[model samples]
Target chain A: MIEGIATLATLGFTLGLFLALAARFLKVEADPIVDDITAMLPGSNCGQCGFAGCGQAAEAMAEGTATLDICPPGGKGLIENLAARLGVDWDFSNSTTNTVPMLAYVQEATCIGCTRCFKACPTDAIIGAPKQMHSVIDSACNGCTLCIDVCPTECLQMVEVKTTLTNWRWNKPLPLAQLPLAA
Target chain B: MPKLSIRGGVHPDEHKLTNEITITRVPTPERLYLPLKQHIGAPAAPDKVIHEIIHKGQIIARAQGSVSANIHAPCSGYVEQITDWAAPHPSGLPTRTMVLVNDGRELRDDVSTPVNPLFLRPEVIAERVSQAGIVGLGGATFPSAVKLTLGQSRNTPVLIINGCECEPYLTCDDRLMQERTQAVMDGIQLLAQALYGPDTIIAIERNKPEAIRLMEIACKDFGNIRVMAVPTRYPMGSEKQLIEYITGRQVPAGKLSADIGVTLHNISTAYAISNAVRHGKPLTHRIVTVAGDAVKRPGNYEVPIGMLISDLLAFCGLKEEPQRILMGGPMMGQALPHAEIPITKGCNGVLAMSRAEVKNSTEHPCIRCASCVDACPIGLSPLTMAAMLKKDKLDQAVDIGLKDCILCGSCSFACPSAIPLVHYFNYGKGELLIRGQQQQKDDEIKRLIQGRQVRMAQQEKEKEEMIAKRMQAIAKRKAAEKAAAEQNSEKEIA
Candidate 1:
């Protein structure tokens, strides 16, 4: 039993030393804050924020070089969340542009089908063959607007999603006294 | 006597003031707005049905899907353009509605007389019910034909007709049973005939003893039909609760009542079924109760399906200013945004409540009193679910039986602190549904992105391979030319 214990002890010590050496040698250099910020991004890689990608934008934000409101698609909600997380003062008045949730719409009549929009689209929401008309998939689109700039015929446009009976729901009901008089 | 089987129900004031009043027919309104989605399925495609002259009892919109129900024109009129109009929901959003102008001709497209229901085959009866656009008139509004077909296929041993109109201030079903005794009974018989059932039973709440007595008297002739009076409770009218109270069988969570070999039919649904099968009539009109302290005349009215609440209320006349207008019983009915909304097939009652009648309690924090827990009919802890929902922990709330809640408003009624527990549940349920739709969208987006990435990589690889092949071919051609030139040079030297 003593011999077996000694063997196990030696084996454990050797493996522990080897693991320590390996961990030290194979350690990856990373900024955790940057990674966290990257996860918070919309991740469409549309590059509307003027950064190389979501990762680069995250890196710039982490280094205090990039403005907090760089992401147009993220809109006001993302900025408020970021401000809360970063413990920064946010002035709502300073932001001139207010963005609502938008989806890319394709005008089938005018589509040139140069394949530029599809090549530019990060989500590949646009479905079409070369030299044919393209249409946007409502569910697949994240409203990145990357395809809009590339469409040569300017067929693509951003639009708010239409509310239907199936998707509609009660917005917190008003008290009885506040109800509008029916005409 | 045996104790009441089902537990955790509130005994709110019934306020059945119009119980004794017989159903009065309301004059047809000038304009009617019939919504396409009166039932819980795919909206009827009325695009093609338009342009044709509409008449009373004529099908204006055919059932589009397997789960959908047909929509019939209540009265004869010219189509005034199909458009989006105010819906009956609390949201007040516009839905697709068929607008018809009353010509006052009272002309029906095809008026057929009553036929003997006993001679018809069960399948034929179901088909006729479907053609007549019959649906559950007990506020559920599920397609009656679908339920009949489902019940018939299951070979369910016994069928329980729900006469337990437990909602307060709603006596339409009671009035239906008391006045149209033979009609309701005939409907039940017709439904049973469609099912080819082994046994038929009617369950009426003890509160409606008159209805019970009459139904019992009606059942004496038929050996298969029996009447059982259950304890009058708030949610006893619910499918699951009633099923449990009568048969002592709890429908397992996330499963249909039919899975347990039980199929339930609402009392009014049976009545409508009888009319469709025998009278050769479509469900164009239904009995509705107009009551509350604000109304001068609180009585049951035979209302057309597409009649606006404004016209109905005006006919009833107002005694006082209404603090709130509810479209069903006070307990579980939705507060109407306005009286201009059209009454659909599912609307059983319209209550123009005065200040004295409105239950507008200010919400308070829970005291951990466990009152909500005791009041919950589905045996869920409303307090815990509310707390979780407040914290936006939807999955946690769902894990604790949020989906099982019948939204009877018992917890809200039972809470001493006046916490709107049911309201929270409703909002939570709505938010959960929206979130579920969003999650589905996200998944679909992810799949499309992955597919795009794969296609891009394949294109890149293919392009590289093609370039490599072209380079190799060019090199081979160059070597062949050089070899041929060397042979020519050697031959000339020789």
Candidate 2:
């Protein structure tokens, strides 16, 4: 029985040693980054980001190749993740500090016959062509700055178009509002 | 009155006269300018050089990454020039487009190469989807490959196909379900096979009875797949809302649908998948609903990717003049000042309304009507959030569930006073993110400052100690010299 136990112990130790050696030899120098980047993400995978997807974006973020603020859809969740992953300080004060949802508007009178803005918009939010008045295709527009930079006649404007009844949301009032006694 | 909703939301006349009509195909244009960026994600990059001969479904541009969708040649044509031009965007931005001058033959090349996707691994299927440039054609344009990967990793148990074309005046999905029901069902079957036979459910709003019937019949043989009708409500097509209505699951804010063992894909996306899998075709042309009050002939037509809105309007027989052209439905669609914009994959409808149809009521202050409160699907207070955003109190707004606002435009649509409530929520959300980013930066700077001060103080202490030691050594040397001089003088006197 003792001999049998010894043999078993020897086999277990041998297997453990082999595993340790293999682990050392085959150690993938995974950019200690991919996991770090994954943690920083909002993890919604909403695809508002332009990467192949959030996983691809996370991989890119880990590799230190992709921009930190590329995800406008993930917005702050994305920014925070990127900041944590890179261990860098983020200064959004000058970088469009307010996250006010921007909408595309056109100065109908100023629009020239050129269709510059239509081609520039990433979401195909604008509709118009050469020698004609241009318009904004609202539903597909994500308010990316690609369209604003493409207008030749400066006809397209990124206006904080007021959210009307058609777009307004009903936010739950604070606890104080529900209690007339408190007021 | 079936619990008539109150608060914020505009009842743009449904104008769904064209909803029941069948989809028609538009003839090839003289020159088709295809934009690389169509979806909400990363813009695609062109693979072909200037003046390259390209066939239909030949991917003109490749999706940059998982977030980006692929771009394909809409027709068999010679590439003219890869130039930057104004695209169909509200920003009136110039984007890189592959200009293809049609040869006028309208001859479609056989780019469809069948692949036995059934035998391949789920990861392999996802890789093929990525290569095919598939995306959510539901206007979000999220890459399909990434979604599949998420489902694979998370062990998704169900696949919910969104056939609920809830937006008024949009009937593209309805037409797709009616005309291509089998294809959609086939795509779902393939998706199920990829996910180890997860139950597939097609969720259609009750209003689209024809679509529900067609989809149900198509999936009759597949016991795992079923068709369920949800309430006919606005934004019933939203990813979160649809999941809740069908499965009683609410995908938490900042979490994916896979987290709840559910995978949601749009109906058009399923059809695209079928085309890619069976026909070996990449996404090129899509069904677009061209309807509004001003058009003489309002109908749904299958259009190429880069056709001008003007051509589509003319084909529909434009009335005297349109007051505005909006892409998508009236409630959530963006307004186009001109009709020069090119349609992309996400574009579902082209609305040209007469001035009479678009006389939006003037904006008024919220009267605390509590109508918006009732309209909120997520149970948010739109007015409070808007007010906080107005005061630049972003943190306060966030505390009140600003993150939950889906921006479905339902609250805004429900508002009688024409208040832009959704705009405020969007603004608040954006501001909260910006402030959080700023705080992160400030914290980083503060740490750097503290580290530098500690180092500087240590260096000062070291310098002072060195100086003190040197002074003590010099005093010792002087004392030794004085003692030697005094001893020498005493010897000379003796």
Candidate 3:
């Protein structure tokens, strides 16, 4: 019993010592600000920000290599939030206008049943079997246009979708305008 | 009378001015614009040809899907146009509408022969109801045929007739019950028969003693039916609340009343069914309450479907240029930008309120008072939901039961700070739907990208295998040529 306990203790101490050494040698000192910026960004990983993903974009921003208005999906909200979090002064004039939300539509007549665009779509918005005319599921399309370049028939087109009554909302009326005016 | 009460409701001021007035049939208008999407679900497809002369009660639009209802012509007229116009929705978006011009003949098509509803099978009754385009006249406008089918399928044990006209300034249902009690009761009996002899209960609020007396006397002839006067409460007419009050059964959240072996129909819907089944007449008109302080003459009018609100308001005689014109009751009605919009199957009231009656209060921040919690009939936290929505944390708001909200204005009315709680919920629901759709798109894009990668890798593997096979073939041919050359040299040396 004594020998077994001793061997186990030795093994545990040795493994713990090795883990401590490895951790010290391979430690990645992640900047807290980078994490905070990443948290502020839309985690879509759409690569529209010219980075591999939102994490890389956040890292570049922390290193002062990337600007605040890099994410298209984040829009003005992310820029404002990120600027506040990073304590940086951002130029609104340099910021690009937010792109209108769009969905991809496939022209069925010219689709050629290639299935090339279907494979390239980042979202499985396209539905069809091999050698069959493919159609885009409008609700599932992010308008990333990833399928546009891959389509041999050039049948994929992006269209802007307007908000319908199902998604329409009443903006809060101005408070002063609603109050009765003194005659 | 034993009175039933529900949890978490508000008693708004009952400004029912037309409660004592009888229903009057208004003269047909010159033009009627009927939006195809009069009811919930898919909009009906226009079946009549443009410029064709259509007789009254002719099918103008057929139901596009199972969840939709047919739309019949209200008066004999020529189809002027089928175009888009501002619909009677809160968003005021343009929807496809069929405009008919009255030829002034007031001609109606010959209806089917009247038959005893009791002699007909439940399926036949349901089919007849569907053909007549009868819908729930209590603001929901769900096709009554669908409900009947569902009740029959579930073998529901109880049928609740909603006579609780609880909305402020809306007395159409109350007046309907008082004037056509026997018709309404007949409708209830027919619906019960369709639902396989379910116990029928007509629930009316205590505020309308006249309607209760009439309904009770009318129901006495039916052995299985009972008329119960429930306590006066705002939104007691809601399907969930009514089901609970009548049967002491709570319809589980995100479920229908039929799921719990109970079916509820509006009193007006029952009355419409009686007319449709007994006389073989289609639903061409409805009783609309035109009441408010701004009206010179406030009373219920039996107005034809597709009549413009402006014509209805003019017929009622407006006392002044109304500050606000709302379709349906004030609590849950949509304010029309102009009076040009037409009435549909769902419209129960046309309230033209004076400036004094409209409380355009300056909205104040919520002080964290729990009055909204007490007023919410569905038992949801409006304050927390509003706060989460303001922060744009929709998932968190949904986690706190945002989907359970019925958009009742009770919380908004009870809030002392005037937070506009219902507006926030509406906005939140809309935003959630948009975001959910976007997320679905993102997921689909990811899947497509993954599929592309898999396909490319497969192609690359196939190309590598072809190249490997070609190289092997080339090597084998070269070795054979070398062997042949060596054999010739050996033979020449010999």
Chain A TM-score of candidate 2 vs. true chain A: 0.48
Give model 1's docking category. incorrect
User: Model 1: runs farther than 4 Å from truth?
Assistant: A1-43, A47-101, A105-115, A127-135, A148-163, A170-183, B1-5, B47-49, B111-115, B461-494
TM-score of 3: 0.78
Residue-level lDDT tens digits of model 1 in B1-494: 33465789988888888999989999989988999999878888784345567778888888989888888888887778799999999878899999888888888856665467777888888898898888888888888898888888887777889999999999999999999999999988888888885488798888888898898899899999999888878888999888887778889998987788787888778888878888888998999999999999999999989999999999999998789999998888999889999999999999999998666676655689999898888999999998876655566799999999989999999999887788888888887676667556655665766678888999999999999999999999999999999999999999
The predictions' CA RMSDs to the true structure, in order, are 8.9, 19.8, 8.5
* Candidate 3 lDDT by residue in tens digits, B286-322: 9999988889999999999999999999999988899
TM-score of chain B of each: 0.93, 0.84, 0.90
User: Candidate 3, residues A113-147: lDDT per residue as tens digits?
Assistant: 88887666655678888889999887666666668
Fnat scores for every prediction = 0.37, 0.00, 0.42
lDDT for each residue of candidate 2 in B1-494, tens digit (9 for 90 to 100): 12232223334345668767888999978888788877767788888888888777677887775588778787887899998766666545577777888887666666635466666677777776777788888888788888898888888998988988888999888888888788888778777776777888888877788888888888888889998876667777878877776777668888888999998888888888877876677777888998888999888899988898888888889886998899887767777758877887888999998888876766765789878887887888888888877755565677888888877788888888778887777667655555565456434433533454566689899999989988988998889888888888988887
> How accurate locally is residue A139 in candidate 1, as Cα lDDT from 0 to 100?
74
lDDT of each: 0.84, 0.75, 0.84
Sorted on TM-score, best first, the list reads 1, 3, 2
Clashes of each: 0, 78, 8
lDDT of 2 by residue, A112-131 (tens): 85777765554445777788
